[model samples]
Target: MRDPYIFSRMHRIPGYLDPGDALILRALLGHQNASGYRGGAAEIGIYYGRSFFLIERQLRTDERALAIDLFDAGDQKSGRKRLESFTERARDMGCVLSEGQVIRADSRTLAPEDIIARIGRVRMFSIDGGHGLAHVRADADLAAATLSPEGVIVFDDFCNPEWPEVTAAILDFLRANWDRLRPFAVSQKKLYIAHTGIGAEYGAALDRAEGLRRLPRAPVNLFGHTALRVSHRLWQRIGYEILCRMGLGRMSAMLY
Candidate 1:
């Protein structure tokens, strides 16, 4: 079968993920999201499913995995779960489609009832939504409540320079729920592993997986240096942004 993440894996921009985020993702790939003992996997962000591709590599075709997103490329699954029930359709359609358990809705508005009714409790959940105080908080709440007790929550865009508000909300959440939301792994791209688990053995296995050993700086450097070679343009864009932020908007536009 054609790889779903081939384009993204080959073409994502550099500095898009830093050393820490790479480590976190590698470590999360080592175990069940809820805890070391739990089973199954599910992802919430389909920003093309970059992380989805990574985790799916660890599973088989028959593994019960769920992918939830607003597949809103003007595709068919582009509405709330409030409408077409996701499971019944999956069964009728023969459950062999490329997309797995597709839910077309903003996770903030996803109904927990449909989830429990359709796929049962999710083992691992990747929360990459809203990122605002209201939306991110609401999504996080739902993820926490819905995740299996031993499940893990993968948070995306933790250190987005363009969106400080999202950073603030995530930090506040970590502070407020310190015990449940331990910052196991972090980086410039902001992927953190939060284990809401109670098993000592499970926690140890995951804790061991969080490290910087997986980041090979060569790929990104070579890609930028020879392949796409977008570094020059990126530097220019950064300079222009600085100028704009410093009250030189007119000059910045000209420079850009």
Candidate 2:
């Protein structure tokens, strides 16, 4: 299957998505599309539209995307710069976003109804907004409320040392909504989850996808549910870095 975005082109945008994560997300979206799932995509905390646009590119013509972020909020210099760069870079890259698709606000204040009102039910919802436990919990709530029956949620920075709360928040949310949601897969930087009814289906499909290489380790047990850990091999990661340094990022991304 073709990638949602050229690696080199995505690399030019500023954000924390790696090729392996991109590959996993792309594969899941492919599975959804193949299964005839129909819905839009949404993300919290869009840092210059890196991952957001990646998912948007894969969306069908009738589908749409929504993004929420505190661009230029609190008078932070970094936020202002990111807002300006996000606009200019998107324009230069020729990515067309519709009105009200990107919102400049703290996600904590937004309701699921607001999100659904803007983009309808979502097939893929990304939570990379605030790292605090409350923030993550709130974002997860929004995702759950707006998700389609077979929708998936991608949580960033899961189990990262820098943001221990992200892991805690996700675990807490998962346990509370155990009957409704089940984790299906996990990458180094993100976690993939879906409704319990279809979690196993999604996991099994991903386990068979050539784009993802399941790790040798045993499955992760999260509150009686299982999540497969998948990522590129060490050699592929090294090769990707080397090729990018050699100005062959687009070709190197094929490894993912």
Candidate 3:
């Protein structure tokens, strides 16, 4: 049976995550389930709760979804509305709002200790905060520090020309923290990173996912570990354009 939370209802949430990228998220989370990996989830950026909600769906009832964003403090009323909308949607989706903590703060200002104290070690953390190099580096550093063993971190807008700084920051982070984290997979808009010990497992899982077969995979050495990189920009664009035509124009415009 199709999982309503991850597959059906999640697609209805308004956000910039393209269907392809969402599929990647589902596959990674699903793999975690199949492998019995246990830990909470988190996102450094929660705009209208699009990707955040999907991450929430993958959580066990006891798991928390820690979301950090500037919210009304940065985006003003729109950010407030997005948070309100996310709250209502979480309720509708049968998620406990209390378990999903939404913190309004600049991600760059958040220290690793602050996150660890608040949310503990997360298995899956999404970094989609400010696209600037400094901001991305800070978020990445925090994620590396707080991620659990076998946990995966998703970096948003990697290799996207529109946000060149994100790519640069990610590369720098990987280069500096090679022993701590490694890139296992790269979708069109997002890159998946994990601890060196388990990065290969995620890469292998993504390689075997049926939905991601068409996305070309190449084996590469990341931080001395065998990792897989999926570079399929053409397929990503095609799928994203189809989603735009299917009524996600605004979201697609923002993402693409």
Candidate 4:
């Protein structure tokens, strides 16, 4: 089932997740839920709950979702305000941010146990906390440690030139833990990873997902692994261009 909240309301939230990546995530979450994969969902760096909200909406009432951020670590005043903004925005979307669900600390300081204690084993974990090499490595370790046997992790800005360290860190992590974790899919903005054995299962879900345009080209080679590449449809791109010319590019993107 398509999520009305995502198609109609997600654009209003501020963040960097591409629409194509969002579509891919929704399909993966659907596949996980349908296959009876039971575990919590989580995001390490939730900026205003944009991408995190997509994960949160997929959780069962019995499951928990954790938002770990350095909300006030840099500066108490600005941090507190940032946390408040996230909370208010979440509440407006009908999700009340409980004290237990929100962990206000640096991702680097957190051990896997700290996360497991709060949300148990995660089925869908997003690592967008920091773009620095050390930051990505630390967050990746935390995700791998707390991930369920068949869980998946989404890494943001994997190959963006603006953050070359993210790509380097992910490559190093993947090389060290290739047997444990394998990437399945790549969107314009995120890399979808899963347990090496079940990586194909998630990739199949994307292949079967509707409204997503897979590039006709062959799968991408990331290191020794292969991943399917997806992007917006041609019609969607044309619509986006039309909207851009009309000064409604954001709205067009949300709709297309």
lDDT of each: 0.50, 0.83, 0.77, 0.80
Compose the digit string of candidate 1's lDDT tens values, residues 25-48. Answer: 445545553333444466666554
1-256: candidate 2 lDDT, tens digit per residue: 5463746687667678877888778888888899999998999988888898788877898898897898863325454677677767777766677777888899999988888888899999999999999999999998999999989999999999999999999999998998889898887789899998898888888788776653332367766678887765787778877887787878875675
TM-score of each: 0.58, 0.90, 0.82, 0.88
lDDT of 2 at 83: 66
Q: Which runs in model 3 stand beyond 4 Å of their true positions?
A: 1-11, 73-80, 213-226, 231-256
Clashing pairs in 1: 33-151, 33-152, 34-150, 34-151, 34-152, 35-150
TM-score of 2: 0.90
Candidate 4 least-lDDT 10 residues: 209-218
- The lowest-lDDT stretch of 10 consecutive residues in candidate 1 is 222-231
Query: What is the alpha-carbon lDDT for the whole of candidate 4?
Result: 0.80
Q: How far in Å is the alpha carbon of 117 misplaced in model 4?
A: 1.1
- Model 1 reaches what TM-score against the true structure? 0.58
Model 2 has an lDDT value of: 0.83
Listed per candidate, the RMSD to the true structure in angstroms reads: 12.2, 2.7, 4.4, 3.4
User: Which clashing pairs does model 3 show?
Assistant: none
